[model samples]
Target: MGVQRLKGKIKLISVFIVCLIITVFPVVTHAMRGDCGYEGGISSGEAPNKSSFEYQEVCFITGEPIVFKGTLKIKKTYKNNIINTTYIYNLDNAEKKATLTRTLNYRTEITEKDNGQITEKTYFQKDPYEVIKIDNVTYTLKNYDFTRSSFIDQKPSINFYSGDIWNKKTYQTGGVNSGRSTVTVEATGNFYGYDQYWGSAETQIINYVISSESVKNGKIDKWTGTAKVTLSLTTTKQLKYEENLPEQSSYKGVYMEKQYNESILEYSCKLPEFDSKGVSTDIIKTKSGSLKIETFPQSQPLSVPDISHLRGHWAENDIRILYSLEIFKGDSSIFNPEQYISRAEFVSAIVEAAKEVPKDPAFEKKNTRTAAARKKKEEEVISPFIDVSTKSEYFASINAAYDRGIVSGDGGRFRPNEPITLADALVILVRSVGLEGMAPGKYPVTTFRDNDLIPYYARQAAFVAQEIGLVKGDTRGYLNPNEKLTKARAAALINNFINYMREGIKKVYTEGIVNYN
Candidate 1:
């Protein structure tokens, strides 16, 4: 019995050893696989027992032609105690240059440490690579096309001034001097294809039209001027505000999708002419400069004002006159005043204002000052003659006034709606009926005793108003002749003249010289 028991114990020991080998064998194999195996030429005895991983490099240019071929390794794990291990080697034979570079990383993990639950994952990424072709031509990662070629071919700027272009009307008292000049330049090359490169130009041109005789020492005795410029893609190209450039290219090709620059320039000036009393006066002022304008198309949020009373009050008069003349036709039924007013619209408004105060018959019919008044009014329409070309809508009005002798212009210039002064109006009014011979003492001269402000040339003619009873002096007997004439004042002055003419007709009727209707 003792011999049989010892034999049983030995058998049990053998079984325990066999179980231990089965449980530990896989763990050892897996641990070996986790380590990196060094590779080198070696004898069979030194060679690694397990398969080793191999790596090689592949490269490509961004926008060139080339080919790439490579091998990818893959390994499969066993599951459910089955010997299901598999290995794969992937290779591609397709011929194509790489537009981008990519990097791949792989990882395998035993998620459940208690069990042999092997999981493998892969990741991919790309990076830029420089390439040199077999022809020894180097290419970068980014490429450009024909559209970019056009912009890149342009050269840097070279600025120069252009001569003035003069526009004239008549020779006598109808000429206006215009100093219209320009600046020309070429755009810089390499402006295209740059991911973040942008270009812009800001320019201004100022002008002064002075009396030929007034130029003594580079200074004009009396002068007037105005300025304007072509704007953006409509005229210029490659526009940017006084702001920083963005990272990516915000522009496309020049033809259809490319953006152009904005050019902003302005000018203003006055004229030298006579007042109602025939006094020479200088009237011109200006604020001329340039700006960089940008355009953005986005819906603007509506703003609710705290106070609504001021809504229509701001542009009331301008709106009324503009609407009456059909100058302010709203777009989509909404008036957007912040929008830039066009030159056509501005000129239209001036024509409307002139129409509002048409030449009166009382001023036109009288033989005394009719010819002179007609001449002066005609002159006003013809000054700065550039304003009225045959194609211009203002041509008819300008020519009509010229024919009626309602105005007279400078040498050949017709300054339309440049802003009129009190003296300018008087010059037109005085010539209407030939008031040259009227005496200063006939009317109430006491009313306008203080006529010192009247320019020497116009004093005598101004006194004629007193002589003709057209004006009774204010309490101070003074006339502010030099003050700028307001719209209301101009109207009042016209009414007064009309009344004067009517009184003269009444006197004639009382004497029975003229028959009453």
Candidate 2:
């Protein structure tokens, strides 16, 4: 959003990557938490499949809440929007003398939205498959499921979430549930969990109200909630001195029992949390602890320019944030802070900041000559708009942004060289992050003196940007939406957007979740 860095004053996520968007504005109303539930994770990673897991589990074996310390081995891959994951959990309860390994085959569907939200649909076309091998055989998991749906405002200052999970793992030999274990693993936020074998005959029914809120702080949202759980586990089946130890060693035995726990469902990250204190840290720590996925975004290099011009400018800090991320690559030292930025330049910068990974979308459609489409499409001199050429330095970002519906051209031509207006920039910025049409009304008014100057099409975007603290009018309270955005002004706007994403979004997601609980 801006060109400068925040000097790490706000703690950015070390491994936060590819999160979702929500266009939530209405106050979310979640019913008071009745029964206890569970949720999310965050973890330190050694490799793609290696992660740490530390959480308190309702252990039937111990008849008390037992802390399960272990590593959740995960291998996740994304194709076309579907994510396939393999989870291998090897856990040991030292205090409770419990040990087990559970493997889960999980999948999720990811859909990107323009309204500042991301939706993940689980078990849509796939079934969750799991296998278990318990040497101690204290219990058996007859059922397991979880739901996780997280939403953050565009300002991203608030994280809104509500979810419920149910389980039916029964004891195999202990005194509760006829010696068959009834075990459940529940989670909250944008998804549902079901097991093919466990859920095929009996459905998992959760009872918490489907409450939604935009708790700009809420009265009912909890990042973690408390509930009473009837847990169970089996004491060792007392096997005596056998006449033949050979046959006894080969014999398999199962036992189970039950216990109830009324405790807060908590998950914390063992990784370095954000710089900000309070609930934000707890959220980050927990989200990071999720045993679901791993993201290691490769960093790119940016050229350093002698931009002494940034000194004393209000946009300096924002510009530095972007600069640290290497958003300004091609430009050199004379970086004009007061000059007008072209539409192409603005689009390119937006695309880069969003990390769209510029690619010409048309190439895939245009090169669809072969039936199998086996031929690799090479980057050619193709352009979406008539005026922009492949040779243009801004071509990739422009094309990529256009393909993603972040920008558009007029009359089949992209006026790349033209100066971008304030109104136009607002539209592009809102669209770039899929934040269009999310304001309270179809057409909203701004607090600017010259609000009438904004074109009819750009009014909604202007309102959204203003509401999200992205657009601030001049000292005279004039929106100046129709005016060409000066370099200094553009720097400020860009920086503001960056703050929304990095600081604001991070704040809500990390800390807001803690509060939501």
Candidate 3:
């Protein structure tokens, strides 16, 4: 009897356990299925969004082809590793009731290579790709029910401009003198224009903060700041054209702040905007003009020791040569004889003088006949780097200066409106003249002790100039090359070069006359 009772209890327990396993296994399976699909588990039932846009991305190296990439996104709360996945759709025009699915189809080719042999393969990801397309638009998955998407582009553009504003009066007071400017940018491109095979474009808001401001005269001249902005995934309607879009978009542009650099005058800041992931980053576009963030007064004070009373002492011939070369245009046609010269203008003059010597890299890509035709139309001259289309006028002199290599640009960025310095001018002049044979003479006399400041390569040129009376000492007996070159000093220096050249010609002529006689 005891054995029988034990057997019955065992049988009953086995049946109960089997029933429990049957009930719990299906529930768990259903939950797992709900995690990743369009089954409307805990997420909305919808597809991802799409758009079509183009960007010119500069490569890390110079002269490299620009790399172009596209992005798309889906809006669903579902997430599955095997099949379909969902994403949060917070765009401005998204429908709360619907979900989004997305996929990326790069029209790429595949190449197959075997050892000692190579085979070329060509494949184009056609529009409306059936394999990649899920319910609306998505990359394929094993289960296919997940709402969270496998692919999306989470970046958008935010750029703009504000006009120039200056506080010139405040500069003299030793306060932070600055100028102000701003830029406003609206979304210009969208990814949805591409075929339906790809998912809609999307972005995730990370941080939208101010980037930087403009600078003037080497100071924090002007800057910008951004107001807080909200992210919008989709537009209220389609953005068929740039003009059709309103000035105000759901995603506001990033802000900017300015800082001053005393060495620079005209300053520009790259625009700030959202990256592919909707994070704030500097927006730089070659097509769109760079952001001019600030303008500041960049004048430095003259030291008491370097101030000299000597002013006007140059000949007409020298000035003419320099002027024709666009090197030295005299300070006030009257030629002031007793004025303190600034160091900045001096550098510019010397650079201009060097430009008189011809250099190539000009006329490289020009249609010479056409350029000459417009010579009088304000389009004849411009810096090699400046735009010839709209800013042809101001760039005339700059263009001439750049070609001679008298003045070089800063990291490919040129500050056209900045002032020049005396030392800066001397360096450019020394380099531009190619003073290979012009070594200093062994004359046992010296005036300026700081003549040693000239670099060894430049020493030969400086010494020769001194020997030939091209560079004269100031009243205080100092060669203030580091000082800002004033217009007056520029005139004087140019005159000196002309004299040097003429005296040599005279010497040669006299020797010839003697030999003939």
Candidate 4:
């Protein structure tokens, strides 16, 4: 709390929840010409975590490159079918030229309809807005209304949304009223969350009318301006196992995600001369910076997860890691590591590992609440599979996977009790990671020995999984795509998938920024 307040500008740092890309220097390296990164660890907290970051960007409002620092504090509380998040920012540019203090309060509501996907709508509240000052201009908030909506199945794919915003502001220079602007914005954007890291980018069309202090001939003197705005927000959350902070534990050392949002508003606008009173000129502004904060761990494993039966097993370590991370769980002492995993089990584990599980509805008031407030939550989804009962133990997970597009029922029946085939399992895993789109429309023969045996539906998934190092041939050099997946093999593959997200995907993100030349 104390260290984060020192950052200098509001025009410099912004939100991570509405973020885009994860391109920055690695921690411990010198700040590069066009990048900035941090080297420290996180602090423990009850809810919203706290952290800060620095970056080098072409200033969106100043039209010049500047190094900037910022701090973002975010707190979330769950309430009836919605998660309300509070974003607090303390921003400062490196040169001490600009600063901003603001709080953004927003709520994302998830409504589980009869459809197969989760529909989310985000709403922002207006009140107690802070001032945003950049150099000579001070932007005082007057009114704001913004909303975004999207649908996601439990995968790492992009969260696409279309939104509309109307924001009113009054500006003053040297404490004197300069103008008032009504800014209208339309946008379609998306957030892509890879495991351990996430990003979102938005390019918006904004039009604003700047009204002067006087009116001429019964008309208020105003100038209409339009611009193209692009904001690139980058961040990746990693669990620190090698840090000097809190020691790693099943109940501690897990870290929440961070956000670094850079706003770059650049366009060519020509002001028209009226009565020869204004000079015709082109104006452009490109201010960019990001705000990222790290908070303490908030989630822990459900229980010790009796891995006693996994002793000397090949997938022992993998299973242990997943259990520690709360990504997978097991039954009692009779751990069947070599047994075939059911479709329901595979889908549930895959979704949980991807971290796309939606929250249940908020608790109702003790007193009789309104019907809307008490709308059903425990029964999150009505099973699309005729074979899956609402009372089945796997009902929630199976329904969730269906909603996320991770799995599908055949002829309206989900064979929950049947073993999941390797081909089917690979498809689910590949889909969960959001790389299924890389599969070519005209498929090529796979390089595996059993290429001829690879099922049609699993061909793409096999290709993608193999390319990403998530799959390798067996001792006999066979993919065995048609075989049922054993719990042991499933754990190994799932662990590999997690590693790919933590290390392989990260390699791409980091190396791309450093070697873009």
The digit string of per-residue lDDT tens for model 4 on 196-281 reads 22332223333433333333344444443333322222333334333236557443233223323333333333233345443222
Which ten contiguous residues of candidate 3 have the minimum total lDDT? Answer: 189-198
lDDT score at residue 424, model 4, on the 0-100 scale: 80
Candidates' lDDT values, in order? 0.30, 0.46, 0.29, 0.51
- Candidate 4 residues lying further than 4 Å off, grouped into runs, are 1-302, 325-332, 355-392, 411-413, 442-444, 475-477, 501-517
Cα RMSD (Å) between model 3 and the true structure?
36.7
lDDT of 2 by residue, 197-289 (tens): 000000112222111111112222213222222211101101121222365543222112111111223333222132332122233221211
Query: What TM-score does model 3 achieve against the real structure?
Result: 0.27
TM-score of each: 0.24, 0.57, 0.27, 0.53
Could you tell me which 10 consecutive residues in candidate 2 have the lowest summed lDDT?
194-203
Measured by lDDT, the strongest candidate is: 4
Q: What is the lDDT of residue 120 in candidate 2?
A: 57
Candidate rank order under lDDT = 4, 2, 1, 3
RMSD of each: 44.9, 20.4, 36.7, 14.6
Q: Mark the regions of model 3 whose C-alpha exceeds 4 Å error after superposition.
A: 1-394, 413-418, 440-447, 455-460, 475-477, 505-517
Model 4, 471: alpha-carbon shift in Å?
Answer: 1.5
Ranking by TM-score: 2, 4, 3, 1
